[model samples]
Target chain A: MIEKQINQKAWFMVLPVFLLVAFSAIIPLMTVVNYSVQDTFGNNQFFWVGMDWFRELIHSERFHDAFLRQIMFSGIILSIEIPLGIVIALAMPKEGWGVPVCLISMALPLLIPWNVVGTIWQIFGRVDIGLLGHSLAALGIDYNYTQEPIAAWLTIIAMDVWHWTSLVVLLSYAGLCSIPDAYYQAAKIDGASRLSVFRYIQLPKMQRVLLIAVLLRFMDSFMIYTEPFVITGGGPGNSTTFMSIDLVKMAIGQFDLGPAAAMSLIYFLVILLLCWIFYTIMSNVGEESSNGGV
Target chain B: MTFNWMAWTTPTATFFIVIFCMLVGMTIWEIKCPGGAPRQSILHFETTRGDRLFVSLLGSAYIHIIWLALFASLSLWWAFAIACVYALCVFRWV
Candidate 1:
């Protein structure tokens, strides 16, 4: 075995990335923290309010409902996208002219801006001018996402699936590609059924990537804002108001800076906590896999 | 209902023309200097060619201002052409 030297030079290589992340992420986070503890009465006037906003947010029924809605949305999105992505990945041809075309087509939706995606769906779901709306109306279906709560939920969910399922497919495909052919050959020689092969070989191989996919989808879906906000505007009696939407409403609409800041902190913490849990479980599984190999 | 046939046609035509010219130019360059040409320098910090194109075309203030100007002048075809060029640039160069 060759001994590897620890290279300090790579730290310099990573410096630019660190600086960019700090500018984009850390500074804004610090500003949010600053705003959370201060009471503001417009025109930059602020007074220290120390934990008042936090207490109020915790007690607010609106916050509670928003939180529950957020959880449900995230849960539903994960359950749908992950399995769908996996199946799509599995169904995709491994090698041929079709691969690149399929990959590019799948990736196209993800490349569109979040706001544009919302606009596309909004138009697509419109009963008057939109294709989907016109077809549904022609077929005698009472489908108006703008008015109905269930319609709003279904449209948002479908839009999210269309937008994000490709990520899971791509990640799972990468994981599948990395698995050595020897494993498959051995399984085939053993006369393993397709389901058994998937169960025993494909799934274990995909565990790490699936963990990553789960965590990414969880964080992203949990903090989803632009698409749903543009489409639903958190309307239909606030049935679709996720936490981020609620935060924006408080901060910008109501100008309740303190409460919004507090809620933002809570939101950040929840994501962090969930991410940590995911990381722990994933790492432990990785360790177990490596140890089992030994 | 708001579908404009003329709005789509001009830009689509312009886009294909630009792409055709670029590809033809690159092919000519390759034929004339089979052995070598100066390598294009790229900014190391940028993510991808596509991302850079997106920044230049849609994210840039100038491009947006130009687009708005064209739209205001009712040069909708011109606006569409610019949009097509924007898409083509992103697809080809990033």
Candidate 2:
């Protein structure tokens, strides 16, 4: 029998994390919670409203519309990105000079700042000068993101795919790279089909990374603000107004601190809840796979 | 120390204090009874006490919001009552 040794001094190493979380997350969260129940009319004066903002926000059509749009955007991006990333990862070369080329190219999009990516896409989707818009127009498509709701959505989706799919790609590629050659050699010897290889060998290995990729993509897309803000400013008649963008508009544009704070709380709650659901469901799937092994 | 940066109202302050107390209590409870022996609940997923607590808290938030949305003129004490029942059901079954 082995007696496990515990270190008392090891607790010191964890103090910094708690301190950081307290300052960064807990303090600001407490502030937001304070603001959510209070109304202000400037000069640092505030009055208690007692859940009035949360009540109002729950019934607000604008909030509902923005939330639905956010959900739709997240769903669309996840559906596209996850599969596309896996496919790209599968296609990537295992050896030779192409490996670095593929890895670097896949990484380049992620390296760009979010706002800069937005600006680049905003220009890239212009009807007059930009390549994508011009090419679409030249090909006889009615393509004006500024004018058309559908066009704006299409542009945003394309921009998001171009910018963030690389993250999924890189994660999946790493997952793929982790597989031992012995597994592949055995599969080949066993006369396994490519589809069988993917279904059995590749996918199971990629599960954890894909879970991470899915959660990251879901959260990022759900809280999408900068790109759409830069590109459309939540325009084309509130077509691209995600929850975060709308929250910003409420907080800064209208100076409705209470409602904005309430909205922020709700928005954060929704993200937290959805992420938890994703984690639970995915882990359940993992557990089932492990238990059954079929 | 001084805490003047935020304009804290009683209800809001109580709200945070309650959350903080619940967290501390949960930590103590976890230390006292390790693992909590994850169980497959009515939701058809395995969850420990912490997971159930999170689900309950999140559910209570939605319940309160919905109650406020629907019954604006009514006293909020009833909503709180309903949330308590919801939490009980979660802890008992889920």
Candidate 3:
């Protein structure tokens, strides 16, 4: 075996990333961990609560409901956005000036602040000055998102889809663009139909990007707060109260720091677990496909 | 209940119309030129036009989000200003 040289200087190059992550993620995470195990009252007085907060959170029905809502919201959006994005990506022009124009348009929604998106929808869904609400009302549908749970759910889902599907589209489009012209030429020579070509070639080529898109969408949706908070304020009655919103209501709104911190830890763990599972499964699928081809 | 097409606000209508124009422009552009060649920019990575657009948009979004979070009470115009500068840097380097 050949001897490989290890460079200590490379450590300096990576130190910035490590420092940034520690400051932004690790330190705050540790603070939450510290808070999770201790009960605190005014003036920063604290008592060791041990596992009490976690135990209570795990048993709480409100926590469970919010968790379920978070899960359900992520599920609904991923199912819709992934396929919808793929279809839109397929329809998009693959080259030239069209490439930049299409990409920029798709990315426009993603560039807007989350709260602004919620505010836009909030006004857009108002029965008085809103376009959608007024149109729905004029069509003889008694649509009121504020008062109706189903309507609220629908509106939030629509808003999320509108906000995020572009990410999927952009990812898929990038994946599509990476496919060589030779692949299409080969498909033509094989007399493969459009659908078969897409299924065999395009979908397989897109798997890695699709995996990234899915994981990103999952984590973001799971941690969703600002947009829905602006729109519904977690109610007409707590109908749109997802996990993050609930956690905020507990920690900041109610000053229940211990329980909120515990809940946040659990929430973080769930996202990590799900993302790991997704990564493993998708990567294994990728490996299997390459092996089968060989 | 009667439907009134004119009830749509100018901002909302303008939003959709701009999106429509973009789609139309893209279609016309594709008809004119069929493919993009990847080019090396100031950024080390080779990028196509689409990639550059994506990087700019994503970077701008992060800048805006961070700005909003840091200065919640302040006017957002500064964020827009910074985003414009960020976009320019991305287009130039990335």
Candidate 4:
């Protein structure tokens, strides 16, 4: 048994992050809350209109549609990126000079700024000048992201996958690399098949990183605005208008501050609730699996 | 017509070229001394040099993204400054 020194001075190191979060997150959040329950007109005049904007936003069909679209986009992205990332990670070279080569190349897309990604895709999908557009047209494919809703969705999804799959790959690769060589040597002694080895050893080792990857991907994709906004400007006719774009349009574009503020709160709560649920469930599953494996 | 290389703008070409050079450099470094052994850090899990780079780059991207989302009209220099700080922290701790 050892006695630990409890020093309150340790909290000093944490103070910076706390202060940063307060300024960046809490202050803005409080401002939004203040705006949400109030009405303002012209020269700094304001009136309390408690819950009116919240009621309006909840009853709005536009909010529901955008919310559903956001959900669908995240769902589709996860389904594609997770499996694709894992497969890429598995196929990647595990040793020698190839390891860094593979990792750096895979990470290239992720390092590009989001708006630049949007611009690249936008240019790459142009009908007259873009490579992809030209080739597809030459091949007799009716691919126009600006004209068709399905085309717009597909392009956005593809763009998201291209931009983000590297993140999942890197996380999965880290997880894979963490497994001790002894585990593989034992499996070899048992004459375990490749699939079985992956199933038992690699998959279990990957559980923690995969949880992190999924959560980060989910939150990022759910809040995604820049790329899609730059690409289609929420599309030809609100076909691809996600929640973030819609919120910005309402608040900044239309200056409906009250409604936008209320909507922001609702959106924030939904994401927070969903993330908590995902975290609890995944951690519980991880614990049970480890226990059972032991 | 043969491929028109000029269609690619300066920034786009430069981005890809830089990434290519970095990849080549990393490959040479790895070949000279293959080093991926995980070492203990401030974080609970062991991490290699490559992991540190990933964490730094990813965290910086997040900093920029958050700044862009919150303050769209402003120049990104402030975001870049903040991201630099974030990168330093990730390199030190994560």
DockQ of each: 0.01, 0.74, 0.01, 0.01
User: B19-94, model 2: which lDDT tens digit per residue?
Assistant: 8899999989988887875898998988899988888899998888788889988988888899999999999999
Predicted model 4 interface RMSD:
18.7
User: Across residues A137-254, which tens digit of lDDT does each residue of candidate 3 receive?
Assistant: 9999998999999999999999999999999999999999999999999999999999988988999889999999999999899899998999999887989999999999999999
lDDT of 4 by residue, A1-294 (tens): 899885769789999998999889965776676677677663555567755676667667999899999999999999999999999999998899999999999999999999999999998887798888888899999999899999889989989999999999999999999998999999999999999998888888898999999999999999999999999999879989999999999998988887898889788877876785677567767877798973
The Cα local distance difference test for each model comes to 0.79, 0.90, 0.82, 0.82
Evaluate candidate 2 by giving its C-alpha RMSD to the native, one decimal. Answer: 1.6
Weakest ten-residue segment in model 4 chain A by summed lDDT: A42-51
Root-mean-square deviation (CA) per prediction: 20.3, 1.6, 20.3, 17.6
Please report, as a residue range, the 10-residue window in candidate 2 chain A with the lowest summed lDDT: A285-294
Candidate 3 vs candidate 4, TM-score winner: 4
> Which parts of model 2 are misplaced by more than 4 Å?
none
Candidate 2, A34-138: lDDT as tens digits: 999999998888988887898888888999999999999999999999999999999999999999999999999999998999999999999899998899999
State which docking tier applies to candidate 1. incorrect
Residue-by-residue lDDT tens digits, candidate 1, A1-294: 999895669989999998999889965776676677677787766677655676677667998899999999999999999999999999998999989998999899889999999999999999999999889999999999999999999999999999999999999999999999999999999999999989888988898999999999999999999999999999788999999999999999999988898889778777766785677667667667666862
Encode model 1's per-residue lDDT on B7-70: one tens digit a residue. Answer: 2234334644665686576567656765333222232222333334334443332343345433
lDDT of 2 at A102: 97
Docking class of 4: incorrect
Top-scoring candidate (DockQ): 2
Model 4 residue A142 CA deviation (Å) reads: 0.8
Those runs of model 4 whose alpha carbons end farther than 4 Å from true positions after fitting are: B1-94
Residue A200, candidate 3: alpha-carbon lDDT: 85
**Model 3 lDDT on a 0 to 1 scale:** 0.82
